[model samples]
Target: MELKVDVLLTSPQERAYHTAKDIAKLQSLNGTAPMLRNCEGLRSRSLGDWEGRLAAEVRGTPSPPDAEPLGDLMQRGSLGQLLPSCYAAQLLPVPLMVEENAVWNGYYRE
Candidate 1:
């Protein structure tokens, strides 16, 4: 079956943005490709002082002073305010998906 998309939401990071851009090229909504919207909420967590360090080196160490907390990450990633409005507007998903759509990647709900 042909795929459809109403909206393509992605993290502002280069990788996610490019991936979504590629997917947007292959899908269409109302005969037009959807635009890639950069959602800061979808961004990878900020690691602060630990950002450039190797995982092996930082694995068991205490969190850096500026590291984002897991709870904060979850809250931001949830996109609670954004989701309901998008759902109400009947937006489909790329990464953050709606339940009825079968193309879940990292789609968040609630």
Candidate 2:
């Protein structure tokens, strides 16, 4: 499906930015590509000292002592947290999500 996207806000990571650029290529406003911006706060969870470590290698490694908690990510789009709590407002995670399309929307009903 095609979407009329005027702007795209992505995390500061290179992969995220690249993905946004790819998506923007498919989006348009009056035949113009969407604008893209990198947001630092929107970055994925920082692995801190755990960067480059394999999950299997550290399955019981206790994680980095300085790593941030996963719950902090919920704050970005949920209750009073640091992630802005506007993920849904931004129409983020957008549409065409397989889990959403095939599982959540496919099974649940009001």
Candidate 3:
């Protein structure tokens, strides 16, 4: 017996991992398991320290030049180097998962 496969065409954005669980349910009804493909890029911009802090606050203080002017540094470093690296990594077939809590838990497990 020859097995025939049906091609299901769907937009990568519309079928992203954000709706993976939902898509899985729908696919199951149609007798197929939903596979999540990581089309979304890395967790690029945390923008943590630079959120509301002003350059004036840390400029004249003991803070380093990079930390004092984080916005500029981020634009130069992250936008220039980091984002390009992330984009390149996204092109690869393998998926990169960032496990934040796991790293911390391993370091400071009580």
Instruction: Compare the candidates by lDDT and give the number of the best one.
Output: 1
Residue-level error in angstroms, candidate 2, position 52? 0.6
User: Could you tell me how far off, in angstroms, the CA of residue 73 lies in candidate 1 after the best superposition?
Assistant: 0.3
Q: Which tens-of-lDDT digit does each residue in 1-110 have in candidate 1?
A: 66566577776677777777777776753377876666666677889999989999999999998999988877866657445534545444543332211224444434
- Model 2, 1-110: lDDT tens digits are 55555556566677767777776676543487766765454666767788888788778777686787887754652323211332323433322111111211111111
Candidate 3 off by > 4 Å: 1-18, 38-44, 50-110
Full candidate order by lDDT, most accurate first? 1, 2, 3
* Candidate whose TM-score is highest: 1
Q: Any residue pairs clashing in model 2, and if so which?
A: 76-83, 76-85
Report the CA-based lDDT of candidate 2 relative to the real structure.
0.51
lDDT of 2 at 71: 74
lDDT of 3 by residue, 35-58 (tens): 443322322333355546787765
Ranking by TM-score: 1, 2, 3
* Model 3 lDDT at residue 32: 61
Deviation from truth (RMSD, Å), model 2: 6.9
Clashes (candidate 3): 0
